[model samples]
Target: MTDGDDMKNGSGPAAHSGWRGGHAPRWGTAACVAAVAALLAGLPWAAHGRLPGRLATHWSGGAAPDGSMPLWAAAVFPAGIWLLIALVVSLSRRRARAGARPWRGLVLAPTGTVLVGAQASVVRANLDRTDWHEARQPVWAIVLILALTGAALAVAWRIAVHVASATPAIAPPELDLPEGERLAWFSHAANPWLQLLSAAACLVATGTLVALGVGLASPEALWPVFAVCGVIALASGVFSSVRAKVSEAGLEVAFGPLGWPARRWSPAAIESARAEQRRPSEVGGWGYRLSGHGTTVMLRAGDCLVVRPRGRRSDFAVSVDDAERGAALLNALRRRDRAGIG
Candidate 1:
C-alpha cells in the first residue's frame, strides 16, 4: 500500500526492479482528469437553450430553492472547483511515480462523477423554467447520482490495484554485521510549521472555550468551533515530531514530543527495511497518512525509514534523519537475530 516505489532495476540493494508500465498510467490519468473537467464545463452549455437565466444551485431541505447563481457562473463555478481538485490530485499522483496510487483514483473518480452529475441535475431541474425559484429539487436524480459515484469509485479502485500489482516487489538487502559487535542507530525529525499550526489551533480552541464559558457567544455556535479547533490541535500536536531507533530489539518509532505512543517491531517480525525519499504530497500531505503506500508518519519531506512487517504486503514508513543508516542498522539486527547471535 506504499506510495513509494518498490525498487528500480539496478546492481545495488538500493535498486531492485524497473517499472514496466512506463508512462502510460501517468498520461492516462492526466487524460481522465482533463476529460472530467471538460464534461463538467460542458454539461450546462449543452442544455443552455432550455435552461433558465439563473440556475438553482443550492437548496434547503424543502422543495424550494435557497441559492441561485447566474447561468454562466453555475457552469464556470463547478468546473473551476473540479479543475482545482484535479490539479491537487494530479500533483500527488505525479509525485508517486514508483507505484500506482489508488487513493488518487478513489478521490478523483467519485468527486468528478459527483460534480458532473450535479451539473447535469441542475440543468435538468432548471430546464424550461422561467425563474430559479420555480425549480424543484432533483431528489431522485441526487440519489441516482450518488449511486453512480459509488460505482465510479469501485471501478477506479479496481483499476488502481491492478496497476499497482503489475509493479514487481523488491527485497531489501540485509546489512552485514561483524562478529561479537553490538550496533544501534537513532534518528529524529520534526516540522516547526506543524508545531506552530498546532499552537495556533490550541489558541483558537482556548479562546472559543473561554467565549462559551463567559457567554460572549452563542453556546451552540461556539461549541462547534471549539470542537473543531480542539481536534485539529490534538492531531497536529501528536504528529509534529517523530523519533526512530534501531537496535537489537528491532525498530522503535515514537510519535510526538512526549513519546508516550510508539510502535515497535521485533527483528524477526520485520521482513525488510529500506530508506526512501518521499514527499508529503506523495503520501497525501503531512502528519499520519494512509494511502496505497500503506501507513506513513510524514512530518516533513525527504528521507524515510520504510519497513515491511512479516506476513504483511504493505510497508510502514516514518520520516526521519539519516533514514538510510537507520534502515541498514535494522536490517543488520534482523540478520543477527536470524543467525541466533547474542
Candidate 2:
C-alpha cells in the first residue's frame, strides 16, 4: 500500500483515528458559554460610561459621567476577568491529561491575552463616536491597550516557563533514510521563519505609515489601510495554493492575487525533494514566506516538501497535503533527469 493509504488506515504515526469520532469536551463548551454570558452582561456598561483608575479614565472618552464608571469599562472589565478565569479552568483540565504539562498553557497564554486586549480595544474604539482626527481619542486608547497587552505577554511568558518545567519530554521519531538519500531528505524540510519575518515587516511598515500621517487620519482612512493589509495577506494565500499542486508536467506555483499568475518548473531543474515534519510556529504560523536561506510555503501545520535546485545549495520548502507522494514524484523526476530521459 502507498504511504498515504497507510496513513489513512491509522498505521502511520501521523494517522488520527479519533478525529471523526471524538466527542467535544463538556468543560470547553461550558467555559465558552460562561465567557459569552459575561460579555453579554457587560454590554450595558460598555454602552454608557468609563471604567475606574488610570486605565479606566484613559479608555473612557473624557465625556464619562461624574462618580460613575463608563459602561464600556464595566463591560470590558467583566469580560477580561471571565477570560482569565476560563483560561485557568482550561489549563487545569489540560493538566489532568496523562503526561500533560503546564508549558503548553503558558505558551498559549500570550496569544489569549493579545486576543482579549485587541477585542477590548476594538470595542472601545467603536463605542466612541468621535472622529479619529478631531477627537484624537483612538490614539490614546491604542496606547493603553498596547501597554496592557505588553503586561499580559510578560505574565504569559512566565507562565509558559513554569508549565514547560512540569511537562514531560517526549522523544522525536528517528527519520531513517537510505545513505545516499540523506541530503535529499534534509533539503525538503520546511522553515517557517521566512513567512513570519515577512508578516512582521508588513505590520511594521503599515504602522510606520500610519504614525507618519502619510494616510488620511480620519476613521474613514482605516478602511483603505485595512484593504492594503488584506492584499498583503492574500499574497501569501495565493502562494500557498500554488505550492499544493504536484503533477507530471512539473511543479506549478501560484504567484498572483487569486492565483491568476502561475510559474511552472520542469522536473529537470529540481535537484532533490523530500518530506519533513513542521510545527506551526517554526513555519511562520501557516503562510507564504521567503527566508534568507530559501522560500517557504505553508498553509496550516503538518508534513512539508522541500525542493532544491539542481546546481544551487539553498532549498525551498512548501507545506503540502501529500508531501510523501510529492517527494516520491520529485525523486522519480531526478532519476529521469540523470538518465537524460523525460
Candidate 3:
C-alpha cells in the first residue's frame, strides 16, 4: 500500500545491492598453516629413510640419496612455498577485517595460477622419465590431490568472504495494480514435469560420461546420446520460459536452444490465469519445470500464477518477482485489448 510496506515486503530495488569487503576467515588461515606445519614436520622423516612406501618412491627417479632431496623437490618445494604464502595472505586478511571482510575475489587468480604452474612443472620435469609406474603413484597423485584441495579451499574462502561482506539495506519497490481484476502469478517452477525431465537429462548425461570413461560405452555412442539428452533438456527449458510470459490477448513464450525465441498466444482462444504460491517441494526444485499439470516457468523467485486454457485441462504456470502486480498488469492489458486500447 505504501513505500514502507513495499520495502518491508522486499519489493524495493535497493534491497539486493552487491556485497562489500575483502578478507578470508581466521579458521581457514589457521587450517592452512597447520597443514603446512605438518608437511614441514614430515620432511625429517623423508631425510631419515623412514618415509612410508607411499612417500619413498619418486616419479622422476628412485628416492634421492639419504641426505639429498628427490627430483620431485622442484615441484614440492614451490607448491609448499606458494601454499605458505597463501596461508600468510589469508591470515593477514583475516586480521585486517577484524572478523568481517568483503570478498576480494583477487585471491582466486594468484592461487589458481600458482597451482597450475606447479602442476605444469611436475609434468614437464617427469616427462622424460622411463619408469611410468614411479610417475603415477606419489608425484602425480599427490600433486593432483593437493591441486584439487587447494582449489576447493580457495573457492570456499571466497564464498565465506562474500557471505561476510556488508550488504546494502535496500528493498524493491512494489507494483500498483487496479482493482476488480483477478491476478495470477505463474511460475514454471511450480510444475514438476519440467524438473523431472531436466533431472533425467542430467543423470543421463552423467551416466553416459561415466560409461564412456570406464570403457563400457563407445565414444561415438556417447556423443549422440548426450546430444539427444541436451536437446530434451533444452526443450523443457523452452517450454518453461514460454509459460512465464503470458498476456491478455496472447501469451509470449520463450523456448529452444538459446531460450531466446518467443511464442505468442491470443486471448480469445485463451483460458483463465490466476496467482498462487507454490511450496518449494511442489515445484520439484527451482527453475523452469514441466509437471503432470503442465509446464511452469520460474524466472526470479517468489509466488507465481497458474493459467488454464479454456476447455483445456493442462495448466501452465510461471513464477515471477511480484505475482499480484504481474497479474494486475496483465489484466489491465487484457482490458485494453478488449476495448481496442493499445
In candidate 2, how many clashes are counted?
13
For residues 1-342, could you state the per-residue lDDT of candidate 1 as single tens digits? 221112222223321222222343455456566666666666667667767888998888789989999888998899899889988877877687656465587898799878877876777678778888999865787798899899988877765664454334444533445566554555566666676677567657755654443234578889899899999988887797776767677888877645638999999999999999999889999889999999999987888899999999999999876688778778877877888855
Task: Please name the candidate that would achieve the greatest TM-score relative to the true structure.
Answer: 1
Tens-digit per-residue lDDT, 3-47, candidate 3 = 111122333232121111111123333444444333333333323
lDDT of each residue in 1-342, candidate 2, tens digit only: 001111112222221011111122243235433544443344344444322221232334454322223455545665666567656766685667633433444434444444444445433443444432222235665575577567756765664453333222222222222323321111112123333333444443334333223222354656566566656645543443332334445565544223336555677888788888775577555555666537666654676777887788877776655677667755765665567563
TM-score-superior candidate, 1 or 2: 1
**Winning candidate number (lDDT):** 1
List pairs with backbone clashes in candidate 1.
Answer: 1-292, 1-293, 1-294, 2-293, 3-293, 9-17
Could you tell me the lDDT of residue 70 within candidate 2? 45
> Global lDDT of each model?
0.73, 0.46, 0.45
Taking every candidate in turn, the Cα RMSD to the unseen true structure, in Å, is 17.0, 14.0, 12.0
Candidate 1 residue 124 C-alpha distance from true site, Å: 56
